[model samples]
Target: MGLAKVSSFLLVILFLINGGSSTTFTIVNQCNYTVWPGLLSGAGTAPLPTTGFQLSSSESRLISIPAAWSGRIWGRTLCNQNETTGRFTCVTGDCASSQIECSGAGAIPPATLAEFTLNGAENLDFYDVSLVDGYNLPMTIVPNGGANGVGKCNTAGCAADLNGVCPEQLKVTVEAAGTTGVACKSACEAFGTPEFCCSGAFGTPDTCKPSEYAVFFKNACPTAYSYAYDDGTSTFTCSGADYVITFCPSVSSI
Candidate 1:
């Protein structure tokens, strides 16, 4: 056989061994209203094909993610474009890009985030639905077609709508027709104290213990990362899997 033919054969073998060297993510909008999904690639990782887009209720989009990609995905709600200025903005999870695409910008907290680090240590994909940033909407991450890693490849997220039950002080309200809560703010974002933010003297896990606010989130969403150091039950790992991210996921579905 020719040298080129041999090289091609080896490449095919590697592709099969590495599970095609890419992952597919299906982003679904299960909410009763519209949602704009924003994506931000992690530092040193290439951006995906899209940074942001709108998804009407029951709609879904598929994105191909390169191997070793790391990023966070979240949903933006109550978006509008000003006709006079042509500026786009959202009430929650806005990336502040003035356009549909985030263009390398991240969601301005308090936004729930679905975080991922694909093909990481030991070739495992680490993922979690983090409320540590705060909570704008119910979200979940479900892994498909992956070998079980040290951590279980189970569904992870907060499926409950926290806005209605959010503390008055941490509630993000909008006055469309009347005052209505749209999102819940984390204690760190609401107060900005070292004890809550996990900064300064409380930077370490040992020093920074869960507060009453953190406990509130944890009690509502046991599988999510409620605070900065809520890792024990928050993180999950898988090997070579496509992911399905759903916004406003039903509690029973999760």
Candidate 2:
């Protein structure tokens, strides 16, 4: 066979062997305490090998995400599994299923979310660290190991402890003693008003401009999504790059 034909044959074999395309995500836990990482695949998407797992402090794990997959990931803290029932529960980022797998359930509001839509048109990946639900853990997403195409591929997330400064009304307090202010809830989740939730008449970008609560989040994590419609500046794009999602990349008070 000619040289060009030989190269094409090799490419075909590689593709078949690998079952097409995918990306690697290195999930890291840098907090002082352990965190349970939870994964939830988007509607009509195939799930990963494990939906939830334990990550001791400063631990890391690699996850393979298939091409065109969309999903959301978050960290759950202070979790315990019932020995008798085998049901699991967490103080933060709890899904209704009450099991480790999450099994098609998404995280409840007030939990920091790392959202991703991979291998979209032009082979680009779209991702963001979103606080629209609220804030529980500090997280960051960095593109690595590829020619990440243009347009703000810079790392994005909340690295600060928004909980420390969270307004009283938005603070999520656990009934168990010594677990107060563990998470900071969004105004939308706390108030459930049309203006805060961006629903009803306040559904449009023009209508739902940033309120004082959103401003607080935006000030702390400038690159992260502060509210439901914080799209233009918060969304990030990259092409053919592996990602590192680090929870609590740096220690912060409160």
Candidate 3:
């Protein structure tokens, strides 16, 4: 109503439009080999400058994400680019685009996912390291600064080498090099049964108990999604903090 009040109201409106504060994601490639990190914004969310970029062993990249943004990130491995088409293809976590820039396409399943919904109600950010899709590379999401004021904002991920113990049924292998497994598949992908996928008769949490396969993943990564109904403990929330996403972080780090 008053001129000063009107000015304050306009500022508040501008803040929402511009996103009150930005969060930086420092993606680190700690793997022994090179990896191309892929990023995809959720539907209707603002896109980042580069969808995919190369990261050699021990290299890192810092990306500033706008407030209220939501998206998923993953690492692409064993990649090769076609000089003519300028398209990139990877052994794991390759999106449909088959290029350096994923555009709006998400990674093909059986790839580890670092999912985030930042700056929501009460200035909290909800994030998780999910193997629900499956595990290609080990990943950890660490919150920095005063993000731990609340309870349980701990690091999350599957830091172990799951592929070594991946059951034969759940092993995904590249065609050209079919001897060794490249990624571990979720029970849902390995077998589309209702019980494994939590679909049809097993759609509800009460109906679908964790299977032995899911349990294997759960044991390896207690903080990550082992199956479709892993929300209870898999999802984590933090406030006013940036993030460090590392591929192949030490097991003790989480």
Candidate 4:
């Protein structure tokens, strides 16, 4: 196609050359089920969805295209469904197909990897592919065993995996992967412990915003700290392995 400009929601700087570079996009799966093909996003006056790529468990696949692509990419992991059967689903059982169906017999029905943003113009970044079973599922990206990524926005946010750390990349992955090295729940509620920590004994529930915690992480350690999450069922605690012993407002954020 012609010059494919990066979307505005993301931060990128595109350079045009005689023959653009050919970079392979990789998708990794650390979750249970397989993910569908894949989709790409663009703004040729509107956002258009592209086809997807299929990957198996712990599988990695790459896609190479001529046009410069960045920003939000879309797609789903569907089963091998039957189109001729009125309402066809890509999958039903274990049988696998791009958008086809199987005979109620197969390995395992594929799951969906929600749409994620892929911007190459910023610091090089890749997505940590994790198949999800449903909508309410928690993230398998951060503090989990998966890949790392960066936001296309200026808003502050860090990513980690089940490994409890973020990629050491310059851009997408940054210096704030684990601010205090001791990371805690953004919302105790998100961790199903908000009422207790933000509102429980010894703790002042819901009194601290993530930005506040961020300030503490930056000021308390400023350099870097050890990160750990103490998840006790209905109670959650995130702190620096060697630092967090008290809660105080970071003078900066304040």
- Cα RMSD to native, each candidate? 1.7, 3.1, 3.0, 17.0
Candidate 2 residue 163 Cα shift, in angstroms, is 1.6
| TM-score of structure candidate 1 | 0.95
lDDT of 4 by residue, 81-112 (tens): 45576543432122233333222222231221
List the global CA lDDT of all models: 0.93, 0.87, 0.88, 0.28
Candidate 4 ranges with C-alpha deviation above 4 Å:
1-19, 45-50, 65-67, 71-78, 86-254
Model 3, span 1-254: residue lDDT tens = 99999999999999876777688999999999998999999887888888989999999999999778999999998899989987789888999687778888899988999999987667678899999888998999998874557535778787988877888989888778666888998889888889998999999999998999999999989999898899988998888788999999998897
Model 1 accuracy (lDDT, Cα): 0.93
Q: How displaced is residue 28 in candidate 1, in Å?
A: 0.5
Q: CA shift at 201, candidate 1, in angstroms? A: 0.8
Per-residue lDDT of model 2, residues 27-134, tens digit only: 999999999999999988877988888999989999998877899999998889999998899889988677877877888777999999987666678999999999
Clashing pairs in model 1, backbone N/Cα/C closer than 3 A: none
Q: What is the lDDT of residue 103 in candidate 2?
A: 76
* Candidate 4, poorest ten consecutive residues by summed lDDT: 238-247
lDDT of candidate 1 over 111-226, digit per residue (tens) = 99999999899888999999998999999999988875455788999999999899988999988825678989999999989999999999999999999989999999988999
Colliding pairs, model 3: none
Query: Which has the higher lDDT value, candidate number 2 or candidate number 4?
Result: 2
